[model samples]
Target: MRIAHATAATAAAALLTLLGTAPPATATTRPAGPPATTARPPAPIAWGSCPDSTADTRQQCATLAVPLDHADPTGPQLDLAVSRITAARPDQRRGALLIVPGGPGNPGLNGPTNAVRRLPRSVLDRYDLIGFDPRGVGRSSPVDCGLAHDDLSMTTLLPWPAPDGSVTGNLAAARRIADACTRNGGPVLRSISTRNEARDMDRIRQALGERRISAWGVSYGTYAGAVYATMYPDRTDRIVLDSNDDPDPSRVERGWLAAYATGAEDRFPDFAAWAAAPAAGDQRLADTPQQVRDLFLRLAARLDTAPLPWPGANPARLDGNALRAAMLDTLYDDARFPRLARLMLAADGRAELPPAATPPDAAMQNTVAASAATMCNDVRWPRSADGYARAVAADRTAHPLTAGMPVNVMPCAFWPTDPAEPPTRITPDGPSNILMVQNLRDPATPYAGALRLRAALGDRARLVSVDSGGHDAYAAHGNACGDRLVTRFLVDGRRPAHDTLCPAEH
Candidate 1:
């Protein structure tokens, strides 16, 4: 869910803790048992400065220790970084609102700072914003596969097939990366799984002394948040899941990856319309949306055979796969449409190539490793290379814009370890305190997938279908109607009696 954008920011991590309040009453049933976790609550944090000097001065940080394996509470533990920005009005405080981030690898230690800027004061007055980095990411015992810098490229991390749609190279790369991770990734990396992440959230809740927690989870975080809600229904208050991924337990990350094709198709028209507009000026690719699409497809195919020289890029060239990757990244937000249009122009020999957008090598290493670990550790993927070839072939024909990359072989196919536990199946058996806001055309977590998650949560959730494009909905994408509704839910603890829609801004 953390797809790289034209200028995607690198992730960072740190730690923090906060005091908690007993949760308000909810309709959720608390399973009758001596609690699931028997470990005593951790001591309150000695909060201090955040690692990033730029983080809001008020955002305090600290670290929590959680078991490397939740199954063994007394086993070796790892540091979990957390951050918090306390409520402005303590008298109106409700509880801690955990800002769960996306990208099984994305860091959330800075989430409080990020959320504080966009969230309304009404909500801020009622809750302390809390954030944390899941294990194996950033400062929380970060792990790396020590991958060759070349494999760290977005084009490679994603299983983009050979120009001829061959799976031979993709399969080899998958095996190679899988082997490297196994050789270098220690127990910390192996311990990275969604289930463990949910368990860690519970630990954070206990450490804060909160009987319950509210959360705003985005993209991949949506899936993580759902698991936490389902597993600890009684422990959750107001829940907002933005840009959801399908919670198909059987497929899990596999389904998330494959959804890219559908996502690209769903979002491309928005980009085309933006790029082809008369106001686009020099960045415009074509006179009409259809012409823009045709131009991009033609340019990509042309580059598939003859790449344009791009100084300073990983491969030092702009090829079809790289172009495809750029397209996906730009589709995340409409403001990035120009980035893709410029690339298309350059690929077509009408303009000079823009500077390569590369993230730091170390961040890429940690992200790629953690991402693969979570995806593979959550479920077992088919190991057959031939099967991948067939799927890629079919997906390419079905979704040409993505060129079969969505269905291509990934390191998970050759993962060194099997999943430790089965994927969590989200059910309607939780507090009906969940609110979901989704863009109609999110290139990463598509609207169709959000619908699936909405269906899975059943009576427990109400969907705010925003008629817009791009990722993240609430307080993002400029839809006042959608933003007001989500903020109302977080501050007032009120949700629509049924699903609703927020029409696109004209």
Candidate 2:
């Protein structure tokens, strides 16, 4: 899943436990582009003991049985894998805090454990951290479109450009993928939209026996949390959304997908600056910013014409698309700076790619299919081919580094089914305790999108924009100021009176 899951000792244990998982038996349908069909809450969560009986006594696991279709609660049920590492101190606990994961396909089961490592002690001391895979992900009833290995490649998953900016391949790829899912994916896979996931979250809150839930949602999770707040405002307590995305009601996920062009454009400058930094240590790009930019663009163009050969990797060669994939992966975090540098060095006949990341097995393939199902089924993409043509043409001209891939076609184009519910409109009337943190120059989820989110949640949220550049900016980004602000809100329910900006630190 593209959404970054939390990583901590707790998550490690949970991840190990879910080594072999399976999908649920029953399923149903929610109307397209509308609120989730209301289903009965999952049967009581079958709480389990954390296998690490010797570790902190507060951590535990359970299985929540939510409706495969909220529209028909008793009709068909699915098991939702859940985990909770109680607050360090129960007496200090305020309430349960759900860790809403980002990717439409990101599983939250391991998040309860991963999030704690980054959460401030104050917040950890005051809330039970609850995490669960949304329907059709991780251990929670997985779903696959029964796709072949070739269709699961990163380029295919992302809808990147053919070497020469041709849309013929893209159109064919989208049609083929969409057709495959419709033929192979079952009801559960078809039901994998975000609206259903939001409803499942509510069921989780109810199953946990909490009338209200404080939450920390990031990336796509921010969208899920916002939808939850919009749908169940009365049940929300303190909400923390990091690296926010725009809430364009007319085009939710589609809008988020399209914004990548701008995100990449905004973020590449940061990489350029980093690569161009003085040769302090092994950093290698250029000694100047302008030179670094010129260097990358030139290499990409060269690779477009002549790709380098590498073995064991899918597609069997390191071409321009491969280079573009590397760029997206690196932009997710700063520590990956070396990755891009190494790629540049290799393209310049200086080095070779490190071991290619392991290709996803069947489960990973299913997970990706689930993700795509959720994205396409959640909302309708622009129906016109011209829309993509215009967008891609503009994106290529403006952001050559991304090759208009950000605005290119995907399964959404050939998405066989329509939305199940009307997309949720994030309004400012939800609970008053939502705190948002964002970096001005994030390479993935940019500040402009976050601002759009802020505008959507007018009075319901207070923004904490930081002058930084990364995918996430809460506890993950070491801006103590941003961290402290979020901690204060999560722990004490204290929020800034107005939107505030944290100055960038060198």
Candidate 3:
């Protein structure tokens, strides 16, 4: 699987335990409009054969010119790379179904190609699948912070404090990263906010000549899709938000960051149970779930003081924070269970260190910068290091598995620029056209957070909860029942009469 942006992983944890009650309602008023752009409507996209590296021959590629800053659309322009696969049965075409990728930084250029293989044939036959790389990402006008190689490491990007829970080093790292972005990232980096992404989506719709468009938005894209639906209610058709995020306007990305503590807590049990099962063979950590948890905790604590050298891994060591971060990443999918299991085995002297997987340096630089730009630009983080220190200490005490990384200081704490506009509040006033599919035990976007999103949408949405663990529910790590609900909704405009739950997949 593709590695998510480093900040994406750090931002996954929550500060508080999973609360049964939903977050209280916030203001319903929409934020002020962006500065008017040039009156010129973009010309229709000129489709061409995709690049040689593109795996799917059916997928055609195109590009659209959008304003670097929507507030000043006439000032400077940026190119957004887009891709599409026409409906298999054009006679029955419903409209374009845009795939909004998860990371604020992930490239969506292959979304259409990837979806065609997973979605039901009926849905594929009915809608043109569309995808795009948002501004300042991938084939779009990319942004780079020009960070040093070490700065690109996930451990550094996540602000993992010292084993003793000190933020001294974390604070300095945050400052260094923030400084690097300010120095190397240009105006394009500043333009990479969620609001701009939503605007870019609208621009894509206009370019496609579609009055309304459908969407399948996952992870952070769910938040962007929610903002788009709220801002342009009439322009949305069927909307599917998989692995939803809480749309708390007051907290926004910070809320996402804080969710990791609860998310890890909720998900760890599944991993524990799997690791202890007899069927796990040589990978079994213990005979019982509780034992597995204890073993993991003990091993992590030991690593805190005496990290083992790992030749191929970033930072070249297996320390407490690295182990914790690895656990967080592996929890996203059951398929990755062996990764954590092997790490545990190595820690216990039962196995050797596995080959480390790393992304290209250029890719990491772009993703990190884009992720930081969107998150830091979307909202203002607390400027006081002391505040983050306190929160991290509290989080570490409450959720030891995450080691306070969720609430710890990040580059955003020292971001040079404030959000251009307030975060958009998701209200229930939009058209009742959204269907959310989520896994009950998702590590990144947990069920508790998904509940907050469900509550926020109110009458505007229906939810299909899958009794499973992992992220990106519909047709991905979700059971047939949940997948059927989402596919039915997208293909036939049918949703459950009310919120529904699917039994766990056997």
Candidate 4:
């Protein structure tokens, strides 16, 4: 995710939950619901002195010791970092709202703090906001592959085909990365699947003493939310799935990985316009919008034939695959469009790129890899190199913008451990309190993918499509219509009777 400058953030569990600065709501009340959990802590629990980051200082920070595997709940539990900021408005208070973050890899503890600041005072008045790092991530028993310094580069993680669509190099990287993880990751890594995350969430909910928890999840978290709602239907109150994922249980991450092709095709126009604009200072990608596309493809092809030498950068060469990876990562938002344009401009000038932003500590990387490993390892990818070759070749022809990265192989293809447990299946038989908000042109979690989730959820959920691009529309990108819809459901326990589209401008 780095070279693409697209990874979420590399924050640790403690730092993520340690602080908050959000203002408090007018009135207040401690929310209530399900009975307290009967699950015993593995060891004597210790309460530490901590100050509330927000007005909801009623917020408590603690560690939940869940089993590394629920199948062995009492065998050996792992520590899960948890934080909660209860509602300040008593009369209006309803229940707990869990902030499930994106990323088979993002830490959600930070997300609750982020949401607390942006939450409408009315909404903040009534619910306890809970955020956590899913098991095996951040503060939990972490997992790592002990990858080499070189393997850390995102360009190495994303499998992009050779300029001519050859899968040779990609295959090698896949095998290498997979081996590294299998060798170093140990037992904990095998325990990090989305299904396990769902199990962890249920355990957290049980620990929180809540009958149902409302959720606002982004990116891959959307998948977990859906899985949780499916697995623990009665335990869900009002759920808002933002920047959704494809619910093709058959392919899971495979579908998400493939969606990037169309995702790029759909979102590129937005980046092209940004790069072409005169106001785009320092980013001289192309004067004309069409030229941006042409120039990128041209540069990529040229690099394939003659990669420009650039010191300090991963590989020390400005290659076609590197350029393509950067573009795909930067297209997440219009605000990042210039970053990609500048990278393109530098490639043209035979200059080096700035280092991708990363978490300051090794713990963060290990946590992220743990999260990603779970998702990548839980499911199976085609083992046949021939299948990958054909897929990459087809992707190149079908989506030139991505150059086959979408359908290409990842470490999953070679990941040694299969899921220790079966993947959780999502069904619409859950509560009708679920609300979905999605951007039509999301690059990572595209609208088409959201539809698959929508179709899967059926009557158990309602959809509010935002006429826009980028991820997480509910609060970050959701317009008035979408925002009001979710807010009403959270505050008043109401929902739309049918699927709806929230106009971008509204």
Q: Put down candidate 3 lDDT per residue, 166-201, tens digits, no spaces.
A: 999878777888888888888888677788899999
Candidate 2 residue runs with Cα over 4 Å from true position: 5-44, 50-58
Q: Where is model 1 more than 4 Å wrong at Cα?
A: 3-6, 9-37
**Candidate lDDT values, in order:** 0.82, 0.73, 0.81, 0.70
lDDT for 454 (candidate 4): 90
| lDDT per residue (tens digit) for residues 398-475 in model 4 | 999888877776777666545444555677786687888888888777889889889888898888888887655776
Which window of ten consecutive residues has the lowest lDDT sum in model 1?
A: 12-21
**The best candidate in terms of lDDT:** 1
State the lDDT at 231 in candidate 4: 75
Residue 138, candidate 4: Cα error in Å is 1.0
Clash counts for all predictions: 6, 16, 9, 10
Task: Give the range where candidate 2 is weakest over 10 consecutive residues by summed lDDT.
Answer: 12-21
lDDT value for model 4: 0.70
Estimate candidate 3's alpha-carbon lDDT, on a 0 to 1 scale. 0.81
Model 1 lDDT per residue over 157-190, tens place: 7878989999898777778888888888899987
- The TM-scores, one per candidate, come to 0.94, 0.91, 0.94, 0.87
Residue pairs in clash, model 1: 15-61, 15-62, 15-82, 16-61, 16-62, 16-82
